[model samples]
Target: MAMITWITDDGRHRQAEVNDGSNLMLAATFEDVPGIDGDCGGCLSCATCHVVVDAAWAERVGGPGDHETVLLDTTASPRQPHSRLSCQIISRPELDGLVLHVPAEAW
Candidate 1:
């Protein structure tokens, strides 16, 4: 299983384990972490699951696609260069251990 660590705006940390094919949003939702709402059930329609991946993992994760980029524009939090909509990210064997941080809010 892949491990995903979540850091809150105020410096709180929460971690979730992802199965080989699990996406970051689903893993976070399953773990009941506070920041990710995942209201669209991993459909990528909502930006509630927005997160900022750690800089070290940024290149490994890559940037969002056009569709995901558009959605990130609607996020409640201010968009950043490293912003990502967690729902669009699918965890694979290669992403065995990923760490993401939640922004202050998600609209």
Candidate 2:
């Protein structure tokens, strides 16, 4: 399992052990992490799972794809340089200790 840490906009933090191959949205939802609505489930249709990869893990996590980028533009929060759609981030052993910052709102 990979240890994923989620940091909320208000500075709250929660960590969960997520199985490898699971996407970030699934991990967060499974653990009931606050600030991640994931309104559209894992579909790429919505930006409710928007998050910003921590700067320390940005390169390792990479950025969003073209389609995801389009959806991110519609997020309730302003998109940042490290913005990403959690549904699009597939977890792996290599991302064992990934850290993500949840926006204040995702809709």
Candidate 3:
């Protein structure tokens, strides 16, 4: 399992041990991480699970896909250089300790 950290806009940090191959949006909801509302349930249809990968871990996490890129633009938070949809990010051993900043709003 990979240890993922989600930092809220107000500076709250929530960590969870996510199984390999599991998308972050599902894991975040299971762990009760605030600010991640997975409204579309990882269907890549909603932007509620938007997150800004920590700069230090952005490269390892890589970039979003074509459809996901467009969805990022609709996120409640303005897209950042490292912005990504949590549902598009899968957990893996290489991603241990990954950090994702959760915006205050997930509309």
Better of 1 and 2 by lDDT: 2
In model 1, how large is the Cα lDDT of residue 72? 88
* lDDT, model 3, position 8: 93
Ranking by TM-score: 3, 2, 1
Q: Candidate 3: minimum summed lDDT over ten consecutive residues — where?
A: 98-107
How much is 102 displaced in model 2, in angstroms?
A: 0.6
- The deviation in Å at residue 93 for candidate 2 is 1.0
TM-scores for all candidates: the values are: 0.93, 0.95, 0.97
Q: Note the clash tally of each candidate.
A: 1, 0, 0
List where candidate 3 sits over 4 angstroms from the true fold: none
lDDT of each: 0.86, 0.88, 0.93
Show model 1 residue runs off by greater than 4 Å.
Answer: none
Cα shift from native, residue 30, model 2 (Å): 1.2
What overall lDDT, based on C-alpha atoms, would model 1 receive against the true structure? 0.86
Alpha-carbon shift of residue 55 in model 1 (angstroms): 0.7
lDDT of 1 at 89: 81
lDDT of 3 at 99: 96
